[model samples]
Target: MRGRNIKKAAYPYILWTALFVIAPMFLVMANAFSAADGSFTTANFARAFEPIYLAVMWRSVELAAVCTAICLLLGYPAAYFIARLRLKSRGALLFLVIVPMWMNFLLRTYAWLTILEKNGVINSALEFLGLPKLNLLYNSGAVVLGMVYNFLPFMILPLYTVLEKTDGTLVEAAQDLGASRAGVFFRVTLPLSLPGVLSGVTMVFMPAVTTFVESNLLGGNHFILIGNLIEQQFLTVYDWRFGSALSVILMLIILISMGAAELAGGAGEET
Candidate 1:
């Protein structure tokens, strides 16, 4: 009976690990390691380090990092507000934070396209206000905005979880000990919330860097992220070998980011 229960408990995790993580990763490695001669080769990865791909890759890292910073700056305030709320209103505020996530992601990007385009609602509104018309669409700024907008909830929710459950007595004790507000936040609240911040940062940055639709639609395909490069290699260029290599490289970047998050989390926990 105990054995059967143990198996049942482990079943879902095993299935998810295999289906979502293992299988897809194996496919990527297989494609990346195999060559055009149908033989094993590291040449595919060698191709990935070429200047053009590296440039796009660096751009992706920069973009994701910038978006992550924006999310943290904007989300931290909302989370702090929600954390300070009375219990009755907390649920409502959280609901508002998460509701947008229920809408289709692509649909949200499309909405941005309409609002930001030349002579669109914003431009018209500016014209009506007798302001200079701004052509804001189809640029890197719009892409960053879309990514930050889409992923903001992810940034907020984790931090909210950590901050909401924090020990109030510790905070009070710090205040009683004469720690200033900023000192308390930097020393107590911020450190205490590091787990959630790490989670939120990881949740925002990794996917933000890899988004294809936002850059394609809102960015006007003028800026090509690593995700966009991979898409081109597969769909437009029809070069699965190079695409697989790019995929492998992209995975490495995410892995590195996640590893750094984990290390930071561990260090914070140790403190």
Candidate 2:
């Protein structure tokens, strides 16, 4: 009676989730194998493997990997500082991390557009100081910069969550045992903090890889990532089948990464 009662109320919510979330995903998967005569076929998956599309997918992976690495380098210090701060100031530091996310993502992207434009603020400042103007916009550098700027909070928040809960006594214990400050960090703190690191990497990377808007606006559509390509196929080219295939491929890649992250976390815990 108790178990039956327990499932009674929860079953509808599960039904709703499966109907909304799982249904769409299954439809997309079905679309991946869709045919002109409305019969199931593997042709779409075969078509998705073409060199041009594969290159676009690969480019997206490469860019996301590089941007995630940069976020780790920059965000680790920021998260660490926030973690080490006194209790009263920690809230302020977290607010700083959060405030940017509340701002419109498009507005943030547009702000970079202004700064990176040829005769914009940066160039104007350079000219005022008798320095050469830089051509920075519409390049891979700009794409990465915009991505890092937007996704930084995602990295810091996850890392900070882990770091804030860290045991300071362990770090101090390392230092008292003839270990240098750097050694204590690398040996003790870092090993313990891998969950946060993994969380940050996954958070920054998936969105960065799949973000079409930043690349379109900042990179000037000169470069194409998988997101941009998928957008073009669905909206511009009117190829839902191909686009669905791309979406499935992208989803699968994300799933694989998430699974790996879970495995990594489990492995860390085991060791």
Candidate 3:
């Protein structure tokens, strides 16, 4: 009777998952394998894997990798520094990092657009100094910059959580053994933070790869990543099959990437 009641309590959650998560995925799979007229087909998958589309996918991965790396480089230090601060200061700094994310993502991207545009803030400042304007807007660099700006908090939060939770005793003991600061960080602190690093990398890279807004806003019309292509197919072209196929492929890639991250995290823990 008690087990039955427990199972009954889980029914709502199970139904919610079926209604939201499982149903949408089923719809996507059905559309991916169906034609516009509802006939079965595999052509969508074929088109999705075509040379041009594959190139777009590769570019997406490459840009996402770069963005993830930059976020890690910037975020890790920020997280570490914040972790080492006094409790009050740490809260304030961490709040600052998170506050930007509370704004709409599109608004944040639009803000970057203003900052990077030819006659925008940076260029205006440059002109004030009699310096030449940089071609900062509508480029790969701008796209990466926007991505890093938006996703950086994802990286920082995970790393900060891990670093802040790290036992001070281990670090103090290592110091007592005459370990240098660099040695302690490299051999102890960094290794201990591996789970956070892996989580941060996954969090940053996944959205970066699948983002269309940042690329569209910053990359202009010329730079078409996989996300843009998928958006085009679904919205502009009205090719649901192709769009669904691309979505499935992207989902698979993310699953693989997540698995790889888990393996890397496990290995780091062992080491």
Note each model's CA RMSD in angstroms.
1.6, 2.2, 1.7
Encode model 2's per-residue lDDT on 141-226: one tens digit a residue.
Answer: 99999999999999999999998888989988999997898999988888898999999999999999899988999889678889
How do the residues 220-241 of candidate 3 rate in per-residue lDDT, one tens digit apiece? Answer: 9988988999999989999888
Per-model lDDT: 0.91, 0.90, 0.95
* Candidate 1 segments whose C-alpha is farther than 4 A from its true place: none
For each candidate, give its TM-score against the true structure. 0.94, 0.91, 0.94
Stretches of candidate 3 exceeding 4 Å from the true structure: 1-10
**Strongest candidate by lDDT:** 3
Question: Per-residue error at 71 for model 1, in Å?
Answer: 0.4
What TM-score does prediction 2 earn? 0.91
Ranking by TM-score: 3, 1, 2
Backbone clash pairs for candidate 1 read none
lDDT for 16 in candidate 3 is: 100
Model 1, 27-63: lDDT tens digits are: 8888889988779999988888889878889989988
Worst 10 residues of 2 by lDDT: 29-38
